[model samples]
Target: MSDSINIVLRFALYLDLMLLFGLAAFGLYSLRGQERVSGAQLPFAPLLATTAVLGGLLSLAAMVCMTWAMSGVSDWIELWPHIEMMVWETDVGLSWTLRMVALLLAGFAVTLNKRWPTASLGLVLLGGAVALATLAWAGHGAMDEGARRSWHFITDFLHLWAAGGWVGALAAFALLLRQSEPRLAVLARTLTGFETAGAVIVVVISVTGVINYLFIVGPSITGLLDSTYGQLLALKLTLFAVMLVFAALNRFHLSPLLENARQTGEHRVAVNALRRSMVLEFSVAVVILGFVAWLGTLSPEME
Candidate 1:
């Protein structure tokens, strides 16, 4: 039944990633685009907001599943004294910390919108910093070591932040599109800011991802492709590639459509195209996250 257990574990991890990234995309879109549009449509704010709330909730569940799987694999399986039990004791403090940071950012996104740049910047920096720092002692980063370990930690931290930013911005963008507002200029500017931030985050995540492969999977390419651990990593990478494709389509094709709408006054077409692209992108991100959670629990081929 080890195979069955592994399958179940993979399934749970997949769900967790999907919920985390999917919610992030929804949140990002709402934060970035919601205020730029009219209110006649479903109002992208509520849908994306719901996505964040649900995504956060699901992410918490994913974490629990991760803890369970990790404990089982490590043979720390004393049912009564498992780390899973301590999640509410002292270990969960970090989880709460990150959640608080996320909530604070969400609040700022709601209240600030565009009126108070200073306040928004301060909150973003503070929340992002705290969220990133906490990861050093939290789940995956806690296990890294040496010079390469720090590299892995920083990259993972940056990846989380970037993922949050991209997903949150996506949520905001969705709202803007839903409003079908005739103001294409506002949407274009917001999308530009999002693209810039996303580009940086993606670079950081990619660099860190490579470092992680080197440190965790080792130097041998054969180790990664020939082992169970490597196979799982490959699967996660595949999902990530798919998410990247969707993100590219949204960034290149749909974003330009928004720009064109502003110039040509075809607001409806731009909004429809952007909205559809974002939704697809968000869905793919969620699936990728699930793979991430599962991968975290298994032993690397090098190990």
Candidate 2:
């Protein structure tokens, strides 16, 4: 029961941080000045602020749950000493503390929109990346040591950011599609602007995914089939491939069609098509994250 709760919390946190980072980064790359914070393009300040605060709360709940699981203490008073020891004595604690701080920083960063929109967005990205990177501690990377540990951590970090970027972009597009006042020009620009970044995201996810697999499961690819973790991993990879198909359709087909429709002043067909594709892609991404959260809790070495 506790394990289930932990996985759910992790999934929520993962989604939260990814959006917090990916959307902010997307705004910087795709949206022009003032549009980012002026609520004219994307409601950057309010949305990010809400996500940041929720992340902090989720982090606290996960920490308390972890402390209970580790120490077998249910009461807050009894858990205090254990919490102190873990927070001060263990690397996991350190990472959790830093994650909390990053979330807080993001919360504060979002509030600075009036004074420094671009700077605030940059700060949010920094905070989101830090918070996201800290999740590596909860994964297989934490078990490694020495030089191999550093290398593994780097791969994990890159893999996370790339995945987050893709997830966040999907969410941003979905949100925009739902807007009452559809700015077709801005939508077209955003779709077109993301081509290069989208390619980079795919390449990074693929390369780092393979590197991460090698680090976690080694060369014994056939051995993985016997374990539940391996099964989930396989499912995740298959879904990712499906996700690629959607992306390709959007990029090579739907996006161009939208541009043509924009010129023709009749984009309802293209818009509706993109809306369906994005919803499906985002749904797949959600399932993948759930698998990720579950896989993190299971041992790949299970035979």
The candidate that achieves the highest lDDT relative to the unseen native structure: 2
Give one digit per residue, the lDDT tens place, for model 1 in 1-303: 443454454444334322334333433342344432223222423433443355355445545545665566444456336554545655444565475456456444534524553344344444444433444344455566687666766766666666655555655566566663535665677677667667776787687678667666566686456666677678778867876786788788878877876777766776887788778776666666556655665666434
The best candidate by TM-score is 2
Query: What is the number of backbone collisions in each predicted candidate, taken in the order shown?
Result: 25, 0
User: Which digits, one per residue and each the tens of the lDDT, describe model 2 over residues 183-264?
Assistant: 8999999999999999999999999999998888887787787899999999999999999999999999999999999999
Model 2 spans with C-alpha error above 4 angstroms: none
Candidate 1 versus the native: TM-score? 0.65
TM-score of each: 0.65, 0.98
Q: Please give the distance, in angstroms, between residue 42's alpha carbon in candidate 2 and its true position after superposition.
A: 0.9
